[model samples]
Target chain A: AQTVTQSQPEMSVQEAETVTLSCTYDTSESDYYLFWYKQPPSRQMILVIRQEAYKQQNATENRFSVNFQKAAKSFSLKISDSQLGDAAMYFCAYRSAFRGGSEKLVFGKGTKLTVNP
Target chain B: EAGVAQSPRYKIIEKRQSVAFWCNPISGHATLYWYQQILGQGPKLLIQFQNNGVVDDSQLPKDRFSAERLKGVDSTLKIQPAKLEDSAVYLCASSLRAPSNTGELFFGEGSRLTVL
Candidate 1:
């Protein structure tokens, strides 16, 4: 069984600043995928960024990026030039890539981010 | 492209009552998922379907919960004799088949349930 953990329950960042949310996971599989999703008050979950387990380079999308350390099983999300719209609950998810395996996504608790103006 | 669709944006029911939710996945998407999200927590997988067949239901409380996807396009999740713990937002999501595409899933605005 694979489990994801988000240690930070709440985080705050000033507008125009940067912040990071930490996440770790335990998995026996060597190949998998990691993702960060944002859930606003609307309750719609939106993808933020994704990182492949085999990739050494981190994944970046606009102001969102991930610091993926495979050896440590750590995948952290970084938000730069934070804005008020970034205030939301962020979830870290994992899925296995093995063929004919369970593809159910395992998610961490969440980190509620507040961006102050 | 139209995203996944879920009905009954909000539902309220008493304990021991029955409730159901409907979902329509994106066109051409072969995989569908149902997730339960408690307040202040992440979404938990309740069931996963691949083309009208269940791929995973290990975490689902089968004794009270039931879900089905017919014709590999539409899905429904039902809870009989609901409990207070069943109060949570139910999210529906869809994605392309795995191994052929990334594991990214498109989610619908969840259906909120309030069990009294």
Candidate 2:
């Protein structure tokens, strides 16, 4: 069984600054996918960024990026030039890539991010 | 493109009552998932369907919860004799492909449930 862990329960970042949310997972599969999702008060979950385990380079989307360390089973999200809209609960998710396997996504307890103005 | 659709945006029921939620996945999406998100926690997978067949439902409480995707297009999740612990937001998501493909899921605005 794969499990995700988000160690930071709450985090705050000043507007125009940067912040990072930490996440770790336990999985024996050699290939998989990692994702960071943002959920606002509306309760809609939105994809922030994604990283493939086979890729050495990190995935970046605008001000969002991920630091994926496969060996350490660590995948962290970094937000640059943070804005008030970035204030939300962030969750880390994982899924296996093995064919004909259980395709359920496992999620970690979220990190509440507060972007201060 | 229209995203995943879920109905009954909010539902309130007493313990031992019954509640049901409906979902319509995006057109051409073959994979659909139902997740439960308790307040202050991440979404947990309750069931997964590939077309009309269930791919995974290990986390679902079969004794009280039941879900079905008929015609491989629309889905419904029902809880009978609901409990306080079943009070959570039910989220429906869809994806174009399955395992071994890019992991991207489009989620619908969840249906919030309040069990008294």
Candidate 3:
């Protein structure tokens, strides 16, 4: 079974600064996908960014980017120019890329991020 | 376009009571999912359905939990004789799975449950 781990239970970042949330996973499949999801106080889970294991270049989406080290089984999310709206619980998730495999997502515990103004 | 819709934003029941949640997925989405999110924990998939057909429900606790998608659109999740540990947020999500689209699932606001 594949498992995801987010070591930091809580993190804090000042407005306009940057913060990185660490994640690691254990999986035997060579092809897989990693994602970062944000859950606000409203309990809505939103997608932040995603990375494909086969891609060497990190994925960047506006102020959200991911550092995916396929070799080290590490995938981290970096939030730049953090705003107060960024305060939420961030979760790291994984899914297999193989065709015909289950498409359900497996998620880590989560990291509570606080953006202080 | 309207996103996923869930009913009863909050529910409270004593242990051994029964509760149900309703979900309406995004229009044209073929996949729907139900997830359980415990406090301080990540969302865990409980059941998945492609249209009206069950795809994967291995993680769902069949003993007390049940879910169904009707006519491949709306869905309902029910818990009979609920337990204290079953108190959590129930999230409903949908996906089109377009090849060119990002691997993102549209989520609802979630229904918070409290079991005493």
Q: Among these predicted structures, which one has the highest DockQ?
A: 1
- lDDT tens digits by residue: candidate 2, A1-117: 999999999999999999999999999999998999999988679999988899999999999988999999999999999999999999999988887887677999999999999
lDDT of 1 by residue, B17-81 (tens): 99999999999999999999998888999999999999999889999999999899999999998
The local distance difference test score of model 2 is 0.93
Candidate ordering by DockQ (highest first) = 1, 2, 3
User: Please, what are the lDDT tens digits per residue for candidate 2 over residues B4-70?
Assistant: 8999999999999999999999999999999999988889999999999999998899999999999
Candidate 1 lands at a TM-score of 0.98
Q: Which candidate achieves the best TM-score against the true structure?
A: 1
- Give the per-residue lDDT digits (tens) of candidate 3, residues A1-117: 999999999999999999999999999999988999999997688999989888999999999998989989999999999999999999999988877677788999999999999
List of chain A TM-scores, every candidate: 0.98, 0.98, 0.98
Instruction: Please identify which of the two predictions, 1 or 2, would achieve the higher DockQ against the true structure.
Output: 1
On DockQ, who's better, 1 or 3?
1
After superposing candidate 1, which stretches have Cα over 4 Å from the reference?
A: none
**Lowest lDDT block of 10, candidate 3 chain A:** A95-104
Which wins on DockQ, candidate 2 or candidate 3?
Answer: 2
TM-score of 3: 0.97
In order of the candidates, what TM-score does chain B achieve?
0.98, 0.96, 0.96
